[model samples]
Target: MKKQVVISMLGTQLDQGFGSARWEHWRPTVALGMHEDFLLDRLDLLVDERRYAKLARGVSEDLAQVSPDTQVRRHDTYLPDPWDFEGVYATLHDFLRGYEFLPDEEDYYVHITTGTHVAQICWFLLTESRIFPGRLLQTSPPRKKDESVAGSYAIIDLDLSRYDRIAQRFQQQQLEDRNLLKSGIATRNAAFNRMIEQIEVVATRSKAPMLLMGPTGAGKSQLARRIFELKKLKHQLPGRFVEVNCATLRGDGAMSTLFGHTRGAYTGATSDRAGLLRSAHHGLLFLDEIGELGLDEQAMLLRALEEKRFLPVGGDKEVDSDFQLIAGTNRDLHDAVGAGRFREDLLARLNLWTYRLPGLAERREDIEPNLEFELERWSREQHQRVTFNREARRAFLDFATSTQARWNGNFRDLGASVMRMATLATAGRIQVDQVDDEIGRLQRQWRDVEPPSVLDDLLGGDVAQLDRFDRVQLEEVVRVCMRSTSLSQAGRELFAVSRQQRATTNDADRLRKYLARFGLDWEAMKAARTTSGNS
Candidate 1:
């Protein structure tokens, strides 16, 4: 007879507070193997709790009736903290050093049922580390009531050879979905059209050091990822896209974290670790908040860009890192350079392929599409289907068009507003009444007086006075000139000077000088005076 396949049944009763008893009655079940003929091995059900052990023992007795030789061992041990890939790898290394578990070539399968996301990531790491035997099997909880009680389960079979491909496809799908969701604000505005075009270009091009400049919340990072996807779809490149915020990489840590470090490179350098650049080799590296990178880091980055090589911290050997670099920043890099804060050479390299995303106010046409998109997202998040009523829609359009809400925070601000409205209108329909309070609140928060105009500044004497003319004369001249036609006409019509009669040489010269000062001629003065008089 074939050797009995060992199967483990792991179950956990989630604490549902007052509802725990009811939920516990419907325990989840798992089934394993290709034929699904394998029964739970009774010897594996080991428990320490007296009452629980008695209950488990009773269950084992029933299981034994079906499969007498199957071992049932249950230990009252706390489930391992959801496997952490990095932590597990470190632990496995230690275990190996201590010769705790000997490696074997035989096929072994470990079935996990309780932990969710953590379990998945841990399993992925284990497969990646090549520590697990055969492929890890993940079983889905049984569906039907009787089936669940009878131990029905969905199984996900992992093939090690296809792991990387599957992971890549999964990541791509997720990224595509995210982009579609975020860019849903359907805008056909010229500015938005240009942005889309630029994104497409970036996606198709394998050129490095792309720079994305825009105000905060303008979707810089989203655009970058979209470009990455486009490239992947077009087969322009093959590799994972990694994003790192320069703002988070501070001081020496930033350099080491980015360029990698050899063991004993620094005080805490315990292992020869691969940095993000090395990890992202043959992939895309997105540097967000590039402006926050310190001067030293900037110099190092510039050198790397120029030489295509960088020395890891405390390592003399230069490592070659050839990855497409995409950077984003809200600051004016030119200003940063002027202030001696940013490296001019680095900026020049990044400036080669630069894209500036316009803020929402500049692309008002996209607001409605974005709103609809947000509504969809909010509905999905709240687990409620909802729609905006005619009045609410009208109110939103009116507010969007009429109010000069700076929207300084751009798409992010709009998204937040949509989320708030969706939350308040979770009754399946959004109404004007439901959104009115929020509108009022936003109105108050967004209210801002426009900055005084240049004309106002001129009137307030903030402007420098011309040494040639007295203020009163200049004021009168400006007033009369604005109210009349050309200087000649204004002088003749308003000052009652006859154009036919030859005026004094001094007066004519003065008129010519005045015209020259304002970058006007006698003909322009005449036309202006005529137009002013008619008006």
Candidate 2:
């Protein structure tokens, strides 16, 4: 069995005893040796003042009379004020750091009963931190004069990993926090769920700038706001959250709005202004569409992030405002930096903690939950309940998750589709016919926004050589061909009115000639369509 060692402080007042009556009076250090069940091999006593050397020797001599085998050693740990928490902790920490410990040969215990309350707290901290490499031992005084003078002792182990219930509670709380960051949507997408988990950990632990990148309507703005609310709830931030869309800010107004301006700073300046940065002091500042900001604004923003000081537009004095930054952008900032539209240094600063949110189309598995969420929101705002018929609901979901649905505008499209169907539902019940009509409307909307990238894919760099008129005409023809089954069908749609005026019409031959002019054959166009569908 390993030897038992107790480290304790000498209680100058309580451990006092002299001569013949010392046994009658109950003293803590003397009672320690008188215990029958608890056998200590060695005792390390800490004496704070040099004046207590004689008293410490007397106590050692008294302990010898009760238990001669137990060895007592005195350490001079001089503390000017034992009541000072910082001073006592530093003193104890230094002593523990230098002390030799043999974990295999000895089991150590720290006696907290003899020290002052501050010293007790320090001992607890040191023991809990494993700096002392021991468990805490607390002893209480006897209640009655006839009771045994050894009193009662309890051992406290500070290692919390051994307790399962406490660990589970901490894990459960972390899950709840992650859910709050996601607005409690119960999303089914595995990748999106994992991303939210990391965001929660970073948002709570760090005050550094974060970059949120995604396409439009992909929930960057909403996520930024949720992060701000979570931090504020944790009491990590004290001021209010300030948000601004960089795309809406222009020219001199952008500078004035972000960094504030002094009275008579510009032509329209009437009074002093506290900018968004100042308003967000001790809080969070979310700059949406950050890539849209000018080069000058980017430079100023870098200064504000590195050193919490900046001068306002036309101001002579520098202002101080310390705030956490969260910047959101739909554009690729690396490309913008290369084009000289955005500063590279600003991108570097924001790139430390970057998270890219997926568009709605990529998270198709989460569409059902988000659909339910949007309907609930609509009901809460409009103050009226709406339900979908079984058939209508199935039809809408099938179409929403289908390959035909582009969802180019991401969650914005889903929200708007739900609102349109809800508004048109008769007596709060949406029918199958309404779902069909909504699907057609969505197809039309997507077609209207289809970019010229269709032609770019087919012709590569050759599309750039064509005039604006040719590019538009060819893009439409290519789209019709990809949707049609054959060249003849595509020609009939493209030349619908014009072909009727002709005496003879061979639609396939006409389309073949158009394809030949652009050096694109029918087989190549069909192959590209097949590849696009599989992707």
Candidate 3:
């Protein structure tokens, strides 16, 4: 068992006793030793005045008489003003700092009943900060005059983990916050769910600008709005959420729209404009497609983000609008910077908390949940319930997760597919025919956007010498080679079906020979594509 120790201030008025009658009257320090349940092993008393030394000794003697096992020690602390919070705190801090603490062998308690309110507060702070390293011990006097002077005591432990209800409440709050960040979608992608959890914590704790990078229609804009809503729900931001597609802002109009403009600032300026930044004061500003911003606009945006103040277009004075920024981009800003199209300083500022959302095809496991969400949303909007038949649902899911279903537009494409099928459903039931039709439409859409042909550059118009069959086959083979990292990987994908039929197959050799028919090699094809890209 650890030794019990109590540190308390000497109450000059409350602890006074005279000769034989001292035992009859009640004293707080003496009563501390009177209780059998709180048998103190040691008592350290704090005294401020030389005049109180005699009373301190008397109290010590009384405590010794009540509890013979208790050892009394006196600490003389000088305090001219008992009510001076700073002085009292400094004195107590120095006293606790000088004392050697053995927490493993001893349990310490700081008594808050005897000192002035300031000293009591100081002791609480010291103990709570673990400088004194103890729990708080508060003592109350007897309620009735006829009651014993021992009164009652309570010990307060500051470690919150010891309390079940409070800890569970905090845990539940964090869960709700993460759910709110995800818009309660119940998404099934493990990596995506973990990323959302991290974002929830950061969104609540920080006001730094976040950069969301992904392909178009990958939910960057919707995620930004959800972040704004979460912060607003927590009362972190008071103003409205202002959003703008930076791709739509161009030339001088971009400046006027983002940083405000004065009347007669430019030829098209008709009246004073507050701009999106000013409107987002004390709130959140989401700039979607931020990579599309010009170099000059990027410079101005960097200044606004850094100083929270910027000069509007043709304005003399700078305006202030403190807002959190969340920037979204489908393009890589690093490439843009190398191309001299984006400002390095601005990209550095926005990259503090960057998140890359995966495209829908990358997280195909979440497709079913998102599909349900889209259907529910459509029902709410159209005021008509729509669901897929058993066979139709299975068919759509099979195709949706298949390698052939290219979700190039991410969630937007998935939502559109769901919408089309729901609209075409008869009597709120989507049949197999409806799903099949939607699948065909999606396949056609993706096929139409396939990479353009590179045969003209590769062949150099060989005087229009080849048949259509050879031309089509060679074009596809070159496209596959260009997309692949190596000859073997490209051959594996191209001969996926044909190679399976052969017991012994060298796909790389087969691919090399096939390319040689068009007078092409793997390295030359890759080089051609690289040259085309750089040019």
Supply every candidate's count of residue pairs whose N, Cα or C atoms clash at under 3 angstroms: 24, 0, 0
Error of 2 at 223 (Å): 0.9
* lDDT comparison, 1 vs 3, better candidate: 3
Query: Candidate 2, which ten residues in sequence have the lowest lDDT sum?
Result: 450-459
Native-structure RMSD, model 2: 11.7
The TM-scores of all predictions, comma-separated, are 0.51, 0.76, 0.75
Residue 26, candidate 3: how far off, in angstroms? 12
lDDT of 1: 0.64
Question: Over 4 Å off in model 2, which ranges?
Answer: 9-39, 47-70, 76-100, 112-132, 139-153, 454-535
**Root-mean-square deviation of candidate 1:** 22.6
Better of 1 and 2 by TM-score: 2
CA lDDT for candidate 3: 0.89
Worst 10 residues of 1 by lDDT: 14-23
Clashes in model 2: which pairs? none
Extract clashing residue pairs from model 3.
Answer: none
- Order the candidate numbers by lDDT, best to worst: 2, 3, 1
Count clashing residue pairs in model 2: 0
Sort all candidates by TM-score, best to worst.
2, 3, 1
Summarize candidate 3's per-residue lDDT along 191-275 as a digit string, tens digits: 9998998899899999999999999999999999999999999999999899999999988899999999999998978889999
lDDT tens digits, residue span 117-232, model 2: 99999998898788889898877777898898777778888888887998899999898888888888989999999999999999999999999999999999999999999998
Q: Which sections of candidate 1 miss by over 4 Å? A: 1-185, 447-535
Off by over 4 Å in 3: 7-36, 43-98, 111-133, 138-152, 158-165, 453-535
